[model samples]
Target: MTAYTATVTVRLKRGVLDPEAETTKRALSRLGFELEGLRSTDRYEVDLDAESADAAAARAEEMAERLLANPTIHDYEVSVEER
Candidate 1:
């Protein structure tokens, strides 16, 4: 097995209400930062052993689907690299 690192990024689906991001955007605007929009995400890095990068990605994707992201409201992406 090869050591790999999987990075999962979870975010709210488009059209969902992200109050935290909206508050941040308002705060930034108050601070004179101009922006078209803002969004928030949660990133998780997992290190483990897998037979291949594909396997690592698959495992990470499963983890995201099962726990990291809420299927009803969140979307997630998984990326894998050698550790």
Candidate 2:
């Protein structure tokens, strides 16, 4: 098996409420930063052994669906690279 790195990114859905991002945006605005909108995301990097990058990405996608993201309110993307 080849060592692989899986990157999982989780973010709120378009219509979902994101208090943390909203707070951050407000803070940035107060600091004189101009922005039309802002959003936040969670990124997870996982190291594991897999036969190929596709396998690694598949595993990461499963991980995201099972724990990294809430299907009802959040969306996630998975990427993999050889390590």
Candidate 3:
């Protein structure tokens, strides 16, 4: 098996209300950051082991879909780099 680094990005779906994101945006704006059109996102870095890069990526995708992201309300993307 090969070790890999998984980069996972999670975001609210378009047209969905992301209260956490919105709150952050407002906070940034209050802090004098002009974030009128800013959107918020979350990222995670994970280390995993698999037979191949493809397999690692598939596993990351599955992990996001099943645990990290809400399929009905969020969008998720994952990339894996073999080590």
Candidate 4:
């Protein structure tokens, strides 16, 4: 097995309500940052041993689908790199 790191990023789906992002957007506006829109995301990094990068990514994707993200309201991406 080879050491690897998987990164999972979870974000709300389009048309979903994100109070945290809204609040941060408002704060940024107050600070004079101009933007048409904003969104917040959660990132999780997992370190594990896998046979290949593809295996690491598959495991991370499963983790996102099963626990790190809500399938009904969120979308997630998984990336893996050698450690």
lDDT of 1 by residue, 1-83 (tens): 99999999999998999999999999999999999999999999999899999999999999998899999999899999998
Candidate 2 colliding pairs: none
The ten-residue window of minimal lDDT in model 3 covers 34-43
Where model 1 places Cα greater than 4 Å from the true spot, the runs are: none
**Top model number, TM-score:** 1
lDDT of each: 0.96, 0.92, 0.87, 0.93
Q: Residue 45, candidate 4: how far off, in angstroms?
A: 1.0
lDDT of candidate 1? 0.96
Q: Which stretches in model 3 have alpha-carbon errors above 4 Å?
A: none
Counted clashes in each candidate structure: 0, 0, 0, 0
**Candidate 4, 1-76: lDDT as tens digits:** 9999999999999999999889999999999999889878999999999999999999999899889999999999
The better candidate by TM-score, 1 or 4, is 1
TM-score of 4: 0.92
> Which residue pairs show collisions in model 3?
none
List, residue by residue over 4-71, the lDDT tens digit for candidate 3.
Answer: 99999999889998777778888888899975576788898889989998888888899898899889
Q: What is the TM-score of each candidate against the true structure?
A: 0.95, 0.93, 0.86, 0.92
